[model samples]
Target: MSMNDDDAEILAVARAGFLDEAQEMLRQFEQGLLVLEEDPSDSESLNAAFRAAHTIKGTAGMFGCDAVVSFTHEAETLLEALRSGSRQLDEDVVAALLESRDQIELLLGEVQSGEEDPGVKASSEALAARLRALLGATAAAAHAPAATAPSQAPATGALGEPEDGGGDGCWHLSLRFGHEALRNGLDPLAFLRYLATLGETRALRCQTEAIPNLDELDAEACYLGFELRFDSKAKREDIERVFEFALEDSDVQIFEPGTAPAAFEELATRRCGEDPKARAALFQCWHEMGMRFKVRLEVAAVTAAETEAETPQAIPHIERRVGPAEEGKTQKRSDRRSGEGERREGGRDRRAGDETRFVRVRADKLDKLIDLIGELVIAGSGAQMMAHQEASPLLVEATQRVMDLVQETRDGTLALRMVPIGETFGRFQRVVRDVSKQLGKEVDLVVTGGDTELDKSMVDSIADPLMHLVRNSMDHGLETQEGRIAAGKPPMGRLALNAYHDAGAVVIEVSDDGRGLARERILAKAVERGLIAEGQVLPDHEVWQLIFHAGFSTAEQVTDLSGRGVGMDVVKRNIEALRGSIALSSEVGRGTLTQIRLPLTLAMIDGFLTMVGGVNYVLPLSAVAECIDVPAECAAQNERISGTFDLRGEVLPWLDLARFYGISPDTSRRRSVVVVRDGQTRVGLIVDRLMGEHQTVIKPLSAIFQHLKALAGSTILGSGDVALLLDVSGLLNAAIRNGQQIRQTGTAAFAHAVLKS
Candidate 1:
């Protein structure tokens, strides 16, 4: 059968949705497995893990991802055993399951890429063998029949043999499919075929009483129901899981082997509603079906009618059935139904509330929305700028109100992109587990402030850098069990990931309680690599930073992880590219904490605009401490590109933007210093004018300007002038290094002359 264009498109969309949902399920599965590994008695985690695998297998089957379905089925079977207490969880089982989880992910990836690798298939088979081994002989034997049989094969058990495991294993199921089942791509017959694979279908009956006449029939609407006797060893939950996808709109009832006849009578009444003719027709259908329970139907129906007459308030206009012995049971069922109705109503209300609270939107759509909002901010600024020039108070006021609303809108839209860092943090659990075992170390990962939120884009990009840091800590920073024990510390090492908002940036710290950086070893490596002079003396902070240089390491030997010295430099570059900074603090015999500070967002920011030497510049409003006039002493040294200024009792370094960027100064305007804080240090920026606050939409600099470290990006002003956005941290570091160079050689005169030119 060939699919048309519309059908193909719908299938593609559904497959994409499935892939996304499968990824989340994988995460949950890994998390549950990790929890169970710590405490095997955690039944909740075991069940959750089983369900995650079961869901993946079921949904993958629907899409015909045969590799994923086959691989996940193995894991699902093992999980089912653990869930049912048929097999006890052990370390070996947990390890195999974790590996199985990874294999399933690879299989799903193949499904997503629409390509298959023979190697993955080979690996899947090997892992499946391991999972089966974990299930032991009895479980493996129990699952062998279903595993080897064709999925749609009919059951072969004899219907007349009561001793052939049909007595207590027989389950009666009633199914009423929703009207839109056909449109939703669900076929009732397919479910029945799937059921046949589970066990023997002793008997089957189809009810067509709801089918309308041909003239009034809708081909797309389903008007069918099924009653069947199924004999299977599967639990009720397992049976229900078969119809999980359809349960949203379909009504499925499962009765155990010993269920009373009155229960069926009640089911018939509920299915038929309050119409007598409909009830009678349904009764006739049941009698004709010749199910196992038909022998007691007449007596049960009469007794139900009498019970209904005695208790008329239970169901209006419906004659009850069941005798005095079953009367109490019937009333209890009615009460249970009422309670269930209330709970269902409450569930609907809660779901409705959740629908209003959260919405799943595509990333591209959100990016487009943020882009439009950026343009609106620019347009609003332009309007406000023009209004002030018109010299009309009313026009200015209206424009100001519009700008305020635009600002609010911008903030709210950006907030939509803010996601908690916890999900990203949670991924490292598995990494830590696997790496620690490989490195022969005992490491505990402690995460704090996971609820802290940051831009979703940053969250995604930061994961790799964080991964490297974690691996580096586990492989290099944390000591092995023997080393730790000999060093008067506990055999177990501690690695912590912490995040918090400070000033206007998010700071993530990865700290490890292990042997800190070896200052002498790092210096020796730096000297050996010609990075610095052999005899040079530097502060601890500067010495620690030498490790970030490309291909710099103090390890005596190279290993599979970290010692190759390829990751730290890349980590630094990635963070710097995000307009962020990294700092390290370490103490001998204690630990090392690597801190990364990043901007809250990249698309837009609240900026303090300024102008120097006819060129406009913007500073992040969060980093701006205060604006003050340049002191007379500092102003006198106009030729100096960098100098110091005194504010109250403290002295802070100041950078002259005009001289620093080689722009001609506007001497006619009085210069002011914008005090900005970068970490613990404060730096003052000398500018010609303080232009107050502006909403800055950041546009990245072209490749030609990539070497310019002081300018983070550029933006357009309301007056249509191009303004450069300053990188405060980078600019301050550059100024300090330049000042140090001049001081080293005592070449103040040459430096001043060079600046003046």
Candidate 2:
């Protein structure tokens, strides 16, 4: 493919447009396929698939990629057959169509990989053979039609993906074919066909903007710029890659009717330069992004006619918009350009690597990043150790600077992985809809405060527990239609899923309006089952906590809606495993609210480094309350685990840290007890000294010690020794539950032989 400079540039530009359209069309194909699966009878889905396939044919034809156009034409013909009922929409037809879709993707991939024309023909021929057999079963052959196919489509609902996000946040791309494109064996318009895959091109404007007179126009050169709105899945990269090869010589620009970034103006201003080579490169980046480098004079007029079209007042004003003839520029570009308009091929995972561009790294990779960070922490401790051994101030200062740099790098990496929780919440709407239908109930799920983000892994696991909670609410927490009507409430129930940042933790609430829990009944059942005592006095949340006990359900009869005594206990276990807490609160006739609180991140966290005897320990700062000197009377009861310590008349349970870890304290008098609360269960942890806040990188303990319940995880101290991270929630639960369990276990274990009925 020896293209003359002019033909090469022209072909390159046109190829860009072609690919954009192709991408838009393919997006439609994917979505249409999904829609068809959701609603097989939906005439809309059928028409959508037909239209997308049809559009691909027209665009592919323009590029002279006879193979692509020709095969796509056959597919369109078969889809029309299905639409007209000549060929049934059956397993065979859909399976063939799916295979055809895969073939199209393979063809595009072959071209992208620069494989020979031989590979392309083989694939295209295979697809064409499949499609050829499926075509010819059109409307006339079916002989039964209700609505006639419209002669022409009322321009596809504005170009680019089918989202009705108002305002003109849409785009139009124009790619021109330069002269000599055909002579070089390159089709000047192949890229334009590719663009059709992206979305529907609402309008295809063949620009003669630079076309010379008939005699002056070279036959081998391309001189057309197409204006198109590619409507499809929003893949920005494929469109840019079509002309990626023509960065140095061709003219190209894309326009977006969307909010412009603040830096646009400054960038546009600095873009005024005389270096043609640099200008070309810079312009290529700016142009492909569809960023408006200069404010359009027409914007004011257009906006006046319709407020919807107004460009923001802050838009950058380029001295003059870069046009086809203007030379491009060069300079260091920002990280946002990595996949500016490119799509990942073959479903390969992408990560924020060492490259400057923004990318999404997997959690394991980030954990590796955190692991490297831990090694850095250990290395820092080693340096401090070395400095102390040498006892030199200069060594200490140099080590200090390196530690500071490491701290900054760690913070930066962690920040990169932190994502808002809102994205996770959005998928629940579909979940609620499907679950409600399954349970044969009419429920509307309302969500709020979705912008709160968390660690990506936390977001991933939370979905399951949240799903179980929502399902419980639907099946058991909410009332039936007849039950609701009798109570003077709306027949339709309301379930709300909300998430927000609270204190240093993420608070997620799944609440429902229905009949509240039967507290007296649960208590009676617990006593009879021997899970509780005959007469136990507890708060509402404590009673609710009993619901999370294994095989505990108060439902009278079991059905599919729940009550086989599973799920809630599992939800509790999962939340606890993540170092989070779940609590329940309810009003008799109002509703039930299940709230789960989570740590901001499972990675490195801020901790308060403290010591009891000779061992150093890290306490999660999120759980820290005020530390105070234990009074003489309170300190005297260090051996009694159930005794309450009085602080301003508040009776907080006391647990000596020394005794809990099975280590002896240096001194018992004039010691401090740090009081921490888990829900309403307050306990004081007795320690010898309190250390200020330290950056704690958590390291999990081995499984052998995991059941110890007193220790959560471990971390490294500045002295290069390991210290345990306390399980604040677990220790609190054990302090209360274990005390109750002890009294029952002593009496019941030896006495059960004579009590069995």
Candidate 3:
């Protein structure tokens, strides 16, 4: 029949839904296959892998996605055999299955892109043949079976076919459609048609006794059921895959030939319908195959003794029994037992359910939400400003409450975009596996603090840089097994990815217990490249930093993995693009640790407000150690002497903000110093005034302001004035450098002044 517009629209929507589901199923399939590689005896993982392929095939059939259906059918065959313990799980089988999973994904992508290349077809067929070989099937004859309905011949015995039924043995399927199946864009007949491509359909029975009269029947309501006998060498999962998508709204049961009666009882109790005749018909059909179904009924007559045993209202009551065809009704027992069984099973499968419960949200949506929340934060600050200026008690009180609520909302919304960094870290597993094998090295990737959460956007942006670092560590930092043994270390090299929250920032460290950075070699390379002054005796930290200079490498020879002298500079640029900083620490014979520190959220933060030379600045509250009043003597002391101040007996290196930023200090102002720490290092920042705390919503600066590394971002204050949010770590580092310069100059100035005086 020619398709109508309505039919076309329905099919279009179904296809879209199928595409979305197919992607998720493919992900599960990949993850399950990876797990199977580690622990082949993991039954749940095996089942998950099988279910993913089975589900994709079943859904694809609904949309007439023959490519996906056919490819997945072959993979599902092997997964089923593994599921039933008929086939052993080994590295070869797992590798082939993984390849098959990829091929299925490629096929689904083709369906979406509407592109069919001959090369893709060839690759798919090759993978499918490999899978078929694992299953002991010949590729050429795999698609040769023809279907025949059982109505053409007498019903065979319980075994479905002959005892020696080489290729004709069939799997039995029972399908009962829910009333809304058609309304949900599902066609029961379409599934059977798709199933035919897998093998032969030997028998078909359509039960339509529940269809209403013409005047009462709803055209969209489905009242169809079918019992089909399908002939194929496919496993049980392959047969059930034919009806996978229909199971949600319909009751579907697949029975292999000679299935026991107890299995039927379990299936019957799981289904709910008002048609007793249909239930009896199902059993009668099974009885025809030499299976017995027992029915029990208890009835008692009303008696005076029974009435005396209880009140009349409480007396046992009986209704006359009628045959199913006459009454056309039956009571559906509550599925409490089945529900309990599910609950028990649920305990074992909670992880799968948890994974399904999570919704994959788009990154752009999160960005939009964060942008809106940032604006709300600025608006809230404006309201507070107006309330304070009005000097009305009620307005101030109301605005304070509003500000509190806004802060809470802002935090909660921002958290929606904070996912654990572990996901980004997990993707490197495949990379490490493949690259290690290629490099002829044995490396263990140990990850910690994966539970540490960071902004989702930042996490995504950092993945490439992190991958580069990990690859560098594996290739250069790690030594060969023989070299490692000679160095008196374990033969297997170790690479680690760790993350933690530190001083208001998320610190990610990638380290390896292998050959560390060769400082002398790096310095020499930097000198040869003119990246540094020749013969400069630099600190080890500065030497390590030279590795990040563009096109700088110490390797004398180039290799595919790491020697072309690129990547590290790009890694630094990428990390810094996220408003973050990277540092390196290495000991000659020990190991190298590359640390990255980034803001928890790029959008907003609680800030300690300070004024430097009449300019407002915000410091992240989490990094502020404490605030101290600068003594008049100390403020009035010589400018050079101001670098080091005795803070409760300990000498603290202080940076005068006005001098550091090239703004003249207001000498008459009462100076306060805010101590800030990055990790274990501390620096004192002297300001003209401490303006208490403020809510700081970070607005990223334009590319023109990219050179200002000391300023993390810009923010709008309560007075609607733009304030620069200070990068605490950057400021601390600068303070340390400036303090060193001042100490040298101060000594020289003191000596000259003493001689002149």
Candidate 4:
């Protein structure tokens, strides 16, 4: 084996993945343990635990991870015994298995760091010895997890059996490449092509369903997976051998087609029992046929007869019905691309009107284009003023169309970065599964609105914050099975990570069904920490939010999971730094939902423009609700009312642009107010005039204005003046919450006196 250190390193990475995967599987094993701990007869949980341990042992061997293979070998031995009822899937057994998982994880960490601590060897060996003892004297001598041992002795269960026995029919081997294989500089197709070097293939099919469109595909990623039906007398070992190099890089499923049907039958029969006698055969026959057909056809199964018969039978009808629609859409798309292509080609000539030319720039370049767009917006504002003053409509219109195109380009470019959150959501399943076992809790991650897309930057940044919230929900919001049962709740807890668009921002909510946030605890702690006033009366939702304040912890004991009082505050700050907001709501005994609302992206903010003292201001359009005319007469009625305003039947809280910031007003007779809301707070901004909608290319505020409560960011208006982009929610909240204490006490009594005064 001339496998150099590079090869060893590659193999090591592969082994690491196996260890990681085994750790994941063991976590699943632990969940099964939880179920079996109570009843111990849950067949599904037992099978799951057995399969997980088996996978860990088998996969560890393939990568030459001797420590992992040997340790998991013992775990597998016990899990097999548990499966066979030789030993029960008991609480102690499950705990031992969980401990093994933890040890395996430690071993993996050591492997990652290039060497294991000598202490690890003794501890791991002791754990293996425990597994061997449970394996009994009947177990084979070389009961190691790997086949690489000098003796290829049968494992504990399959003792003394030949490697070639008990499998028939063509085994369809499906392998899905992992990201690591490509990173290891291995060509995945080389593995597949190498498989043919084993023997003649009966049939083969490469599934490209997951292969993203080339335009959307990552060149460095493997999307196509292979399914091969090999015609050979190869044992499961021989069959599994073709993929030895890729054990960690591929999800290998080696099952005989005929065996699948039989196995399906046996399992079904075991569960259904022959109590129904006569109908059992019929049911099983139907089951076998349906199951086999399903496996054969998969979702892509289209019957040959149906295609052959239906094509001619339905062709004329299909042509009559769908011909126009299909042709029309195809033609439209073609024309659009062609027209756009020609314009781009023309623009490449670089003439005065060459602005129409568009090149497909790299995304990074497009980002640069966006930054240049921001600068261009600034320059264009100056150009507009100069052109307008020179009285040139052509120049103005030309500049105006350029502005329009720039806006359109910006929109299209930003849309490119908007990816659905489903990818991030999918990666969390393993996380939930692993963490749930680590804490000895039962939690299932349910995802909703996964198709909701956001900027790539936002998606990358939002993942960890969402994870923390979800983790907090699982570790703290959820309770142990006993606790849940005592609380009259379902034994199993659920944590849902949901994302959806609201207005112009994406809102991600991590909700759990367990014991919700401790409202009283958070309030008491906040008061004790002097983060809030003592005896402060606030909504329960607001109280739950106090957990997010810096240096806050509600955990009775600091476990490995949480209660360090460090997570939530950082989670809040991370979201806020992305120009987002968070809100928490919980019912004392029910559950808690922590929500994060993030702006569409940093590249653009849809803002509503208005004249605040004759100078323009930009308020995020997502936060703005409506605009109303404020008569000059009732204007004074709201002037001294601090920030509260009366609008129709609503006692709307208001922030006067003229007074709040001490900016001088133009003293106009007519006035307008823009009503806005965020989370739970609502505010009205009183302005002198309503300027139309503007695509606010946000320019970061100077350090001097960064701390300003009313302003979020600044942008250049079409009028060639810098307008402050207001944080509507912040303005009104600072006025409302802060003003609540100073609210001229007894507002009703004060109202009469104030009016009379």
Candidate 5:
């Protein structure tokens, strides 16, 4: 059927929501599988994994993503077997399930793209076959060992009859759809059709007693209920999951084949409310459907005036007689119902609290909000500037108060985008598991300080780089079990991911306890690649950095994992592209640690403004340790582009911005040194003037200026002039590199001479 524009739009939004929810489910699925692999006895994790897969399948079926539904069903079946204790959990089964998880992800991607890839389809089939084979193996092993057999006995019944008087050994289901179900794009018949795929529908009936008169009918509202008997080997949970997508407002009751009679009475009362006509109608329908029970209806007394009042009268009292055998079962059922009532009430309270506490917002909407906030900050700055220009105390004070509020708003808005990095860190559990297995190594990943928060955009960007580093650590840095044992270390290697906030930046460390970097081999590779001169002496730190050079590898032979020499350099580039820095440290016999430092956020920052010549530049205020007037001696040597300065008995390398970017020096303006720290290193920046602190809304530079050194981005100032934002890490690295070159070549004046020329 063709859809109208509004229907299409609603479907699009729903599809997007389904895709997002599917991704989260996939994460949980993978995490659960990992936990289960570690401890097969963890029933909670097994059930969680099963539910994730089941949810994805059910939701995908609703959206008509047949490929996803089909592929996930195969995995779901295997998970169900594991969950039901019909199949044993083993390494092979876990491996196949993990691979199936990956295939489902690919299937979901195909759904998102609205096209199916032949290759993915073939892969899905192969994985599905493998999962079936695992199930087949379980079946074959059933008779071999009592331990591997199904933990629960099969239901006792012939094909056509249950021993407990449940006709046809079929499950009975009562469904009353919500009023908005049809309007919400749900078709009652669609769920019925899906149920057919799970098993055979023995008998079905649709009740129309709830439908109002044509004059009162709402075309969009659903007023239908259904009763059916389904015969399937699938568990009750699986059948219940078929209706998961509509559970929010629908009333669905699933009865096992042997359910007692009182349950049916309760269902009847709930379905048919107080109206006498509706109650009579439902009773007649159930009787026609051959329900194993009877109802006696007695009319209520009413005055002629009450009957003529035009309002619908209350229903007559309906009573059912219970046999002794049924009465005891009814009492037990009542107690169970009491307990379930309490649990459901608690669940509802918790859900209500959660609904009030958290809101699901579109990412693009948040981005738009952030952009608007940035504009507000700029406008506030302009207003404050104008107020100060007026020189009226009252106006200045009012503007200042507004600016303070603006700053607070900016901070709070940005905090909304801050998410804990643990979510990203959690992804590596599967990576470490798979990569270690592929390499025939034993490695345990330890994650610490995962609650450290950073910008969501940054978290997304950093994942790829972190993945590369993690894989590299497993493939290259961590030695095999035999190698570790030979070195007197534990047979299992340890790879740790740690994150924490350091000086307004997030510091992420990936460290391994295995064979560390070999300095001599790295130096030789550098010389062979002509990246460094032969026989040149350099510090250990400098040698460790050679691995980051493009296409640099010290491995004698290439492997599937790392020896291609293509990852580390790209990792470095990606980190730097985020205006972040990467540093490496290693001990010969110990292990290697690679640390990445990134700004807390990229959209806006508290900046310390400075002027070089006639142009304004901003430095991240968090990086500014202190600002000092250039001493007379250093100020006299203004001709030098780069030099060292003494601060509190320590000498620090300093860069003159005017000369570094080739801008003409403004000798008339007194110079000041702004000391900024990047990681553990500190550098002093020489600028023409300090313009105090400002709220800087960062705007990206044009592609043409992307390669421009030390300029991170551009921002507009209060006076409507563009100010360049400095990349503190990049500037410090440049100054330190220049200092190293000068010391090596005895050309401390080389940079100054180049500027002069």
Candidate 6:
């Protein structure tokens, strides 16, 4: 039957949920398989692999995703055999399972993206055949060892059935359809049809005493019930799940053949509303299934008012006050009730643990929330400003407290968007394994400090850049095994991805123990491309930076991995777009390390506000070292030196924001220098005024301002003035570049004149 609109919507939601769960299952399977390849005897990993496959298959079956179900079922069978000790986990088996995992991922992706290509079906079938062959070979090998055993008498049942035979396990399921079952679109026969796929239905009995008189009968109402003996190796939960859609309005009682008499008596008591004939039918079915009835189970139904009136813990309290003659019975009853309570509580805890506590919020939603909070911060600043202007101590105090609370809320809200970078790092494991094997190289990927957290948006944005770096390292930095041995290095290559929080920013480092960048080759390539002047002398770091130039590569032979001069420039641009920086360092025969530094969060930051040439600006609080008044002599000689300052005997390079941005300086204002550090490079920013600390909300600048370099973004202040936030790393680079220009000209006047122009 076709689904109604509401049903279709429900099914869509269910499909999305299934896709999410299936993706997680795929990840689990991938990780577990990788682990199993290293240590095949790991029981936990084996169980995890098997469970992931089985769950994917079962859930796909429920969703009617036949392709996924069919393919995963065979893969699950092989995994089960491996898990059960029937099949050994060799490299071949691990490889096959890994392939199966990838196929499952492909199928799920196709389903999620709603793509219907003919090739997917062929691919799925091919994978299924591969899995079947594995399963068949495993089964043959398992039985071969038992074939030479001594002959023994066949064990037989009373009815001449093989006692320990296959497909003999049976579960008796009792289902009574509610009146609303048919109206709610639940067909008991459909469930039965699906059940048959699981196993055989050895026996079936239909209960029909609820049928109304001919004139009173409602045609749409359901009156049928079922008692069936289902033969399958499926667990009770698995069998019960077939009727999931019907369980809300129907009665379902699943019991094994050897269930205690009390269980049956309890079911009978709960069936008090059923017709006498129906009850007798249920009892007869139970008797046929070997249930023996002895003691009567009487359970009094509590009224809504009574249940509400009594406290949950009061019953035990009242039992404790019972007379001595009735104490024993009361104590036993209380103890049993307590035990049941414990079981129920334990079940609830398990459910709680299994249930996902975190919701997957859309990026836009988080951005909107941050935007609203940013507005609130601006409004709070305005209020504080007004309170100060009004000269009211009480008002100022109240506004201060409110602002404090708002700041806390801002922090908590921003923290919600922080996620660990490990998820991004984990994805490279497969890439490393596949690429290394394809290249015939022995490489080990070691990840450390993966728990470092960064803004979720940044993490997502940085993954591609990180991927490029890793692939570049593997393709270029790492040498082949034979080449490694010739260089007196270990035969195996080592690639590491590490992240940590440093100076209020997340630092991610990708390093490899391989042939470092060839300095002469890079310089020669730059010279050939006219990227640098011929015979120009440059520092090793500057030469390395040339690799980020567009269409720059030193590789003589282009390969599939990374030649045709792509990726590195994109990586630099991507990192720059996030207001972050990347630095390259290498030692010729040892290795290369690419380090990226990104803000802890893109939303808001603690900023040290300052003013230059009457324009307000902010420096990241994390990067700010100290603020000091400019020396009288230095201020007088500012135009002479242009960039360098003697700060307590250190020749620190400085940038005058007023001169750099071409804003006329307000000489009447007292000048100050704010020392900021970016990695090992420290620079001083000359400002007209030190405006103290402020909580700054970072609103990204327009694309036009991207080339401005010094202004990272802008924010609003207490007086509603738009303050430009300084890009610390960019400012540092500009200062260094200006200093280099001064050195090249042998005069600060040329640099100062260029800035003025």
Q: Who wins the TM-score comparison?
A: 5
Residue-wise C-alpha lDDT for candidate 6, range 1-757, written one tens digit per residue: 4547767776676688789888888888988988888888788988898778877876676666777877776777787778767778887788788888888888888888888668877988887777667777746344221123332343332223342211224556767888987666566676776566556676788878678999999987899877776655555555665665454456677764333333444455556444433344455565555332323212235444553343231111111122454445433433322213353356446656756676656568888998999999999999999999999999999999999999999999998998899989998988898899888899999999888988988999999999999999999999999999999999999999999988898899999999998999998999999988989987776788899999998888898898989888999989988989999999998999999999998889999998877788999999998888876645765664354556787666666678767788778967888888887667667789898999999988888887775678999998989999999877755644655433533234323322322
- Give each prediction's root-mean-square deviation over alpha carbons: 6.4, 16.5, 9.4, 18.0, 5.8, 9.5
Tens digits of per-residue lDDT for model 2, 299-379: 322334343333334333443333332122211121122222232211113322323465434457777978899778768
Candidate 1 lDDT at 346 equals: 64
Native-vs-model 6 lDDT? 0.74
lDDT of 4 by residue, 400-462 (tens): 887777777778877877789887887676578668888888876788999998888889898
State model 1's lDDT: 0.79
TM-scores, in order shown? 0.87, 0.57, 0.78, 0.57, 0.89, 0.81
3 or 6, which is superior by lDDT? 6
> In model 5, which runs have C-alpha deviations exceeding 4 angstroms?
1-3, 137-166, 183-185, 273-280, 287-320, 323-347, 736-757
| True-structure lDDT of candidate 4 | 0.64
Give the clashing pairs for model 4: 347-357, 643-654
Report the lDDT tens digits of candidate 1 across residue range 133-168: 889989866654143333232222222323221244
Q: Give the residue spans of candidate 1 off by over 4 A.
A: 1-7, 141-169, 182-197, 200-209, 213-215, 258-261, 272-293, 296-350, 737-757
Candidate 3 — which residues are off by over 4 angstroms? 1-28, 60-64, 83-87, 111-118, 138-172, 182-190, 202-227, 241-245, 253-363, 631-642, 732-757
Candidate 3 C-alpha lDDT tens digits along 72-154: 87888778778766678997898898788778878888998989978889998888878888876433343323433342222
Per-residue lDDT for 28-121 in model 5, tens only?
9999999998899999999899889988888888877878888887888787778667888999999999998889899999888888889999
Question: What ranges in model 2 sit over 4 Å off?
Answer: 1-357, 381-402, 533-538, 668-670, 679-681, 740-757
